[model samples]
Target: MLLKTFGWSFAVTAIGLVAAVFYGGWTGFGVVAILSILEISLSFDNAVVNAGILKKMNAFWQKIFLTVGVLIAVFGMRLVFPVVIVAISAQLNPIDAVDLALTDKDQYQQYVTDAHPAIAAFGGMFLLMIFLDFIFEDRDIKWLAWLERPLAKLGKVDMLSVCIALIVLLISSMTFAAHAHQHGGTHVDKAETVLLAGIAGLITYLAVGGLSSYFEDKLEEEEEREHEAEEQAKRSGKQQSAVLLAGKAAFFMFLYLEVLDASFSFDGVIGAFAITNDIVLMALGLGIGAMYVRSLTVYLVRQGTLDDYVYLEHGAHYAIGALAVILLVTIQYEINEVITGLVGVVLIAASFWSSVRRNKRLAEAEGSTEGSGKAEVSSGV
Candidate 1:
């Protein structure tokens, strides 16, 4: 089952390895392999959260996500996006950015790193909003009741999550880049950069999420009408097959997912610099890992893994929260990719085990209830 599902992913990964070799011989292949591993580790939580949203989409959208989405993720974000960033940040043209990347690797990394504070602020705030909205929303099943229960209570406040995010952003702007916060001091202009970038991220999230919701609502209404039509056709002894077209709603959702993926990629792209700064190798390796993540997303949706592992979504959101904070924190200091990856794995693993235990307990309770019911009937007789 696993092999058939992930066959394409494995094949793409192999192709990535071959591409890496062509780029820099065996050493390039090894670098690609390591970067791929790093990307997969860092973005595992991204795949989980992606599945949560992907399952709600229709089959056509789902396929698009795995296919068209891969192109956007790999080429657009992994390859082109960094170059675009460097170009804009350094006031260089696209050609110049690529030239610098190829000819002066250290200068390229420096330019990219120099843009890190803005990147972190934008990506971090967007991610934090996602985490915050999830935690504040009311859910029947609480994964970590000890923590979630209290958080859920606070959800009653109007725009509470956004307020919290704003507060955090304010604190980070003042503290993370202390010099920039000083009165009329220009040692570093990080405070304004963080503030503006974070606001941009927050606004993007709101716009994308709101528009997607509106479109999805319309799609739902259309589906309901189609379902009614199908029932009428059945009553009239006519066969009807409802064709699920890729409508505006799905298109908006596609946009939403892509933006979400781009936000997630910021950390991974920056982190890849720690492994190797060779633009070609980094692109190949990260692209391969991205393909696998997309494939994994489809597998999860098809297998209904999220439905089975109920608390898995909770864990992913928590990991995203941690990653957001880490991104903001790293604007001033450095953090190891290994540590970031490990934290996500641990949270997801813990959630998986908790879900299993809950399922087992529920099964046992049902069994006990059934056995007692049988005894009661016999006694009544």
Candidate 2:
């Protein structure tokens, strides 16, 4: 299994390199490889988080993720997203904008950089809201907890998030509008655009994520019902076709996995702009990152690593929270991309090492216990 996994990765990498070389020669291939490695290193936490979700998906969705999902990650997000952003912000035709990106690379970067603050602001605040919702919101719906209900009634975080985002948009628009006016540039009425962009981000998150969550819950309920039926059947000594139904059950797991993979790709694709304005480079780097992340997810699932590493999920969520903050800060502050990637890498590496040490200790304790048991048994004999 390990050999096959590595072999596949190697083959993909080779193909990417060959394509890069044919397109842009040695310089291009070298750049792609470096970017790919950097992206992969920075996204280890993404892989772990993705593994948690993929485990819940079915095999069919998993195949879709490996195939169609790759196209979305590589071309849709990396290539088309930036083009769309440029078109909207620059008031250029979409084809013209893409042509500008391909022809005037330096000018394109400047345009992207000029628009970075707003993008950062939108991404940052959006991420912050997601983190807050995930971490603080009650995961369970309890029936008989009226006394603690007041705490729950502290107002809907989602609505509050929207309000805060709107306020931020207003302030940003006024500030940028004044700045633009002072420079004799056309006043960019960014308030509506900013708010709309924020709404788009939120809607995307909810639409993709909400449906995924709903289906997952439905699948879980069905599974539980089936399990109960199976138990009752066993009690009555009745046989059932468990084998035939197993494949159908596995398909839901694939759907869950694809949804999660999409989520994990969000930050990486957005963050790639901090490295290069070239869509091709962004796609190359993030594609490699996505590939490795997919491989890592498989490894974690196969090894049952999450069961052994309790803090791994915590670390990934923490990284997501940090990334969200970083995205938000970028809206108002210029942050180095290297710093963002480094922070994620450090946190994930620390968590993984901690897991390794924990596993070693557990193994030692088990060994000692078994040795003591053998001594006691021998003495008794």
Candidate 3:
């Protein structure tokens, strides 16, 4: 099972390291290794969240995710995206952007950094919407019951998540971004960039996420109705089949997953500059990390890990919320990637332990109940 799940990731790692060594020798190898680890650490929560969505997809769509999706992730997010940003921000052509990245890396890095305000705002807002929708959702399992219950109740209010996201965008833009501009710490138009980018993020989330959810719910409803009709037919005699996502529903879900990945990668792309400005190395390292994340998502689904550790999804979303906040904060202040990575790992670890404890308590209670029943039977005997 392990081999079936992680064989590709292992192969990618070996090949990636060999290529890294060939490119920049030991230093290149070490940087690639660190970048891979960094991407995985910061994205563990991303894997968990991805599993939840991926599990609902059909087998065909699942294959699409591993194949086409992987290409998009590796090349589109890690390599092409940064270049595109540089091209637009630097007012250079695509070829010039690529040339600049290879020739004048410092200038490439600066262009990428200059684009941070808008990037952070867009990614942060999109992730914030995800966290908000999750927390506000009324679910059967509540990891943080005290807080989640209250928030879920408030979720009944129409457009609550959108309202709150807009409010956050306004505050962050007005205070941190605007203050930076006032102090000459950033571009004269930083606040406007943040505001517009944030609005775009919010809209993207609503359009993509909302459509995905709508279609998925519609599909589920159709399935349920068909199942009920089959049961009715079985009164006379018949059979049937079902699927969670198909056709339009699956397509939207696929699009949503890609967008979610893009949002998550924004920080990693920016942070990679701090380690090295070599775009090839960043792509190789981050690409390897991304493959592992995809593998982990598949493993979790096949293993039923989420079903066993009920709070894992909750922990992941909390981590995502922390990340969203950190991204927004980084707009004004620099945040260490170590802190970002640690926040996710710690939350997920805590949730795992909590799940263990819950399982133990339930087992003990069941054992005691069985013991009492046996004693009563013996007394009767």
**What are the lDDT figures for the candidates, one per model?**
0.76, 0.61, 0.76
Model 1 bad stretches (over 4 Å) = 14-65, 179-189, 231-285, 301-305, 367-381
lDDT of 3 by residue, 156-203 (tens): 998899999999999999876764322234544478888988898788
Best by TM-score: 1
Worst 10 residues of 1 by lDDT: 178-187
lDDT of 1: 0.76
* TM-score of each model, paired residue for residue: 0.77, 0.70, 0.76
Ranking by TM-score: 1, 3, 2
Predicted candidate 1 versus true structure: per-residue lDDT over 1-381, tens digit per residue? 788878887998888898878878987877777677657755666787788778877888888887888888888989997667557655779998899888887777666666667767777887788889989988999998988899899998999989999999999899885543222222365888889888987997887677656655665766576668778988998866554433655666677677667666765675554445467887888888887787778788778765666787687678667878887886676677556656656876788799899899999999999999999999999
Write the number of the candidate with greater lDDT, choosing between 2 and 3. 3
Candidate 1 is scored at a TM of 0.77
